[model samples]
Target: MSALQAVAKTSAPTPEYYFQEARAFFDAFKASQAIISYRKSLLMTPAAPQALNNLRLLEQSIGRMPDGVKSATRACVLEPGNTALQHGLTDALLSAGEIEHGQARNFWRHLKPEILIIRQGLPEEWNGGPCRDGQSLLICHEQGIGDEIRFASCIPDIQKRFGGPVILESDKRLATLFARSFPGLTVVEKVQRSDSNPPTAQYRPLVEEHGIGRYIMLADLQSFVRPSLEAFPRTAGYLTPDVTETRHWKDHFRATGKQPAVGLSWRSGMRRAGARHNYPELQDIVPFLKGADFLPVCLQYDMSSSERTAIQKASTKQLYIPAGIDQRNELDRVAAMIAALDLVISPNTSVLMIAGAVATPSIGLHSERGATFLGAKTDPWFPEECSLIKSGDGSWSALINEAIPYLTRMLSKGGRLK
Candidate 1:
């Protein structure tokens, strides 16, 4: 038997064996497997804070965050003197969309005064701006590319506030895109630079030397002011697909003569843990599309040759438009095509985020645990028009079955279609 199966067949399972398996799965980014193994380890021995913390990390990674305050409460109950857990619970509660309360005060009581003193040094404004006149503002991008895109909208707002040019330090791949998207803003790739004259010790110091008195982390822009979905709602003709590249797709759809077309994006981040939460093999969705009069448009990034072939064969006669990763304009084209489609169905991924941003009627398939606490019908991040189809038991087939009627109802609405 394989090593994993062999390990699973242990004569008498030990805590170490389960913990090791859980670690392996977590390292592989197989979140679901890690969660299962960790739960098994916990059952073997409860009151394990390490396992609980790991599980919480996995949950956050998969976008299913419990109210930090609630988690902190449980952690406090388990170990009253665990100050670290209490502080973590406060941070978690704040991140999960809760305002500060007496619970925060209680939790803060356990934290060191020095830590709070240092935190007080930072500016209170979310943008960290409205700095001294003529001072350059350094904005650092954090987290994933999708996050960068989501917060990119804030640049114009910041520019309006800070009369001086804004310097955007971000991932190299995004530098060019940002520069092109936002003219007059200095977009630089995050890189190590050697210099003379009291040379910089770190990247942040370099910004200070460049007269960037105000520093703002990109992810924190949301805290400044909530963005309205209607201002950037998905319009039917928002983005136009490239005729030279998408002619085949256009022709294939045209041949069907007014038939319903649907876009599909099944896989997400390849990291094993991300895959477990967002990845449902293409074959799993094939059975659901069997009798539908819809064309399958692939929007996944970095698809392998075998995966491509599988999707093509499984598509039967439906048109399959292969999108390239290198094409900078591909995402816009995909968004345009998604706009034209009868509906877009996807798991939590960049494509779903984009679809939601554009106001496309989408069915977001999420893990049952993720859906239960996050919400049931609509996502707070997206407009109310966008529907959420969550799994009750985290079963792929069941979720898809539940989504069909929802898609049908959306189609019947006679909304704008390109």
Candidate 2:
């Protein structure tokens, strides 16, 4: 064959080639590379539905909700009949704080394994027409402890909108706290095992005995009530801690010589999908503990006796944990202890939400991923008392070092930002 003929026979790489490479990168956990490959594929074939959908998944996983929404919209437009694609678009929209878009209705359908019903699908109300006043409603659980708390912020709004007997199933840890917080609502404790479905015993009797028929996923209230930024009430928190327990902890800590007290929670229990980037190791926070002069209290859940010792050994500071309080199982007590602290420093987990909700000064260490930001640095659900440290594209080591001065100032103010 002639050299010219041989050269003409050579072909360029197709968009499908790049798309497959992107998928490989995604499976390998090379998020940056996967994104690059997906973009490259799209550049070659702009109408590629799979590429757009996967890109949306990647973006949303990493907390880039706005970009995720854009990609999801494109993919949905290309494949209108695709329920998966439609659900992806809806999920991205909700995560991006588009609460007013009416996407929360079908949201539970998109959960992993894509199941939201407890035993069977309960009759849905809000999606149809004007919900009658005082109708019985069963609100079921979804996701983790932190999400449950974050979603509960809308319960107050739900109460105002619907004059019904509302039965809410919660994590056992949060049951006491939720019952105390919302007076009229019936709160039931249902411990959901990751390996199994939500326990029926925890909710069925209360639901049936109370004559509750219509239901909604607790988070679904986001669209009906907290649909706009303005709808979020400026309050300390919806979950109220036991004032007596709060006082007890405050006195207990005071007898330990009453220094500027700061509560610390470094991690969450579950292995969230593609979103575990910023929780620091116990040893990583040693620098924050060094010379801060404030007493460091352990707010982290499920700490072993060894890990507790490790915390003090790592920070070279004494760690204070109240007697008879289980940080994980007793979330209500955890809230009381959090209230007793002058400040709480944690990753964006349930403890952090507890701090913010209780009006305690908190420094939430975050990597800029979450719908809670509502397209801004601060979470609207939290009061000004809870300040968020927004970090991006950096190691937790660097993020903590950067926060040292701010931490010093906050302590100097005796844990008040003002």
Candidate 3:
């Protein structure tokens, strides 16, 4: 046979082929691509429970929780007796924030078997260990840089328990900051780790390789015990600005007016594909702040003077550019400046989180993806007094409309502009 005919003759179209390709794509973190392949597999075999579960997980990873819940529900229906599918559906429902009283109870009842198995395996004297025992505990940082900063507070607590050194694996950009933030703890850049220690991996791999003994995922530390932000040590005045640099920006913003000057950041890190969709265009917010004395504090990195000028031309109020402020190196200084301001209006970003940490009043703009998980009120991670405005139906205009009232409220409360 000819090469094409020979290949056609030898090859078979099977559900397993598509399912395996979907699995490969998922393992490689190509969630959208995996969804396509998993859908194809499901088409070929209408009742593949594993393929449905994979689709559900892929949808969740890409911030499509509603779709994930639907897929997970379908998977459960296909195999009502499957424990894994049941668990997957429960997780999807919980993460989607749709669990009612009956649904919550049902989820716990279904999860009881697995819970019992784990509880039965635990040692009676699990807590009876030496303070300085040489147990190797690996701590992995999950989510964004702000989350790392928030949760790194647990390292000292972990050190108190284990007494031995705790290896922290985190994002490369955050290595220096985390090292400085948590002194005396071993902070490993996830990308640069040597083979002597297992090379940095995701949460599942790290947990699996470390055998899950005496290890804590940084994200779970808050939930593993009774909930309280008090578990974290409150280091008063943690972020400070350069005195010389601070005076310069203070004077510039003060030059604008006697009115309470509000600092604004409507953008976040543009590294991810979804960031573009989530962040509102700067012009959208300009029309809403008509009478208020606002100062554009451009927290976005890589922005030029021309961009600032463009934004100012769009705004009714004059924009203030601080001298000697570089977004990359001067994050601490920018945060300090934000603290000095009467109020800050920002999108969900590390800067907003920093402002919250400093107890600065802020109006936070949240997109549907963010708002759906984090509620309409104040964030639990930050101060309760800060206002949250949601992007209704995930539109930019909705965010701007919601922000107007909060901005007006902040302006009503008088304080120093700079």
Candidate 4:
């Protein structure tokens, strides 16, 4: 090595030097090196919010939620007033499946007035309060499609424990599905126009108008029902699919004589920048479909015309998609079909959540960035039904390769072709 290069390498890196190095590594997509350099910067200046924040982002970008939780929590502690840091910590904590209610509540408590309009009209949020006999409760919806569904598993639990007439407010798109799933409960559309925090003019009517006694965010229901892994609902599946719809799908697939019908949803609609990394391309899933013993049925909701054409022309292997099924708009029917399937293979989208929630044996193929993936063979949320197969590296093919053997064993045991 040259003397000049050796001397430069041996010289101690200042906090600024390490921070710059970290930024360079981050720009180059060298996450490990960036994290190391950021940590070194923090060692020199422990309360450096920029270094801590960057470190947290790097960890989350690569699906390292536990590391992100620590990094984000430290950042929030170092700069308690920073809204971004607090929210980042909240997200990190949720991703790790550990509800940091205190942090979450604190973060929302300090929310700027301009952003509070999204949740403006709700009554006081219920915090595990004992239910008064015959009192009504409003369960408000928050977050994205997948999260809403994941937390909806708590609805039945609330009904069983709280023993009151419950009103559930969810996204307009999910109102029909939730109504069908949770029998004897009132389902209403959320006032918020979109998932974003910035308020819109179309806030839903206040709970007082509906005669609800109290209210709680849908996500908050977890604190009451699933405070820990052991407390999750024990029922085989929580969301109840329409029996008639299930029968229709069963008959539809039976007429086709598709053996061991397998459902597939290879993409995620997360929409965040670089979030598509969490999804597999139809081409990437083609390898698994090439030699599959089961009838591969397309369950992807947002499949575009071009994507559909691509899937049809991708390989010689035949894949089945049921006729006249509206995957996106008709959640109840789609969920019924999922329940009738022998197996569902998907990424970290609502499809996987629905399949697992219904007790349908599913294989969750996920990237390193899946917070719910949890790096375990079985997920804590739906341990009996959902088996997680995390990609060893970044390649979707690698994940599918590992999942194929597991699927084979599962099929041999009971998921055999009909």
Identify the runs in model 1 with alpha carbons over 4 angstroms from their true place. 1-47, 54-69, 72-96, 99-129, 160-164, 172-185, 192-211, 227-257, 312-315, 323-342, 368-377, 384-392, 414-418
Q: Give candidate 4's error at residue 36 in angstroms.
A: 2.9
Q: Kindly list the per-residue Cα lDDT of model 4 for residues 1-418, writing each as its tens digit.
A: 1432354588966887878877766554466777888888888899887688778777876667688888888888888887777766766676666654433553452365433545555556666666775667888666677778888888888888778789987877678778877887888776645556565534235555657767776766766776665675555677778898898887877777757788988877556555545677678788767656777888876777887777679877666867787888777778899988888888888888888777788887755533343333346666545454443224567677778876776666665222
Q: Which number leads on lDDT?
A: 2
Q: lDDT of all predictions, in order shown?
A: 0.56, 0.73, 0.58, 0.71
Model 2, backbone clash pairs (residues 3+ apart or across chains), number? 1
Model 4 alpha-carbon drift over 4 Å, by segment: 1-31, 40-50, 57-67, 94-116, 192-197, 200-206, 368-377, 389-393, 416-418
lDDT of 1: 0.56
In the order shown, the candidates' Cα RMSDs to the true structure are 7.9, 5.9, 11.0, 4.8
lDDT rank, highest first?
A: 2, 4, 3, 1
Q: Which regions of candidate 2 are displaced past 4 Å?
A: 1-34, 41-54, 57-65, 75-88, 95-97, 102-111, 127-134, 191-207, 272-278, 304-313, 385-392
**TM-score of candidate 2 versus the correct structure, residues matched by position:** 0.80
Candidate 3 vs candidate 4, lDDT winner: 4
Better of 1 and 2 by lDDT: 2
Q: Which pairs clash in model 2?
A: 134-163
Residue 360 in model 1: lDDT: 62
Clashes of each: 8, 1, 0, 2
Evaluate model 3: give its TM-score: 0.58
- Assess candidate 4 and give its TM-score to the true structure: 0.81
> Residue by residue across 1-418, what tens digits does model 1's lDDT show?
1476686677677766777787777656566677678778878877776666665656554545563344455666777766666655555554454422322333353244322212212223334446576777777655465556566666766787776867887767556546655767888776443353322224555555566656666755544433332333233221233444345555656676776666677766546544554556667677546745666666666556887788668866544655443422456555445555556777766666666545566767664323212222345454423444432225566567766666666666642221
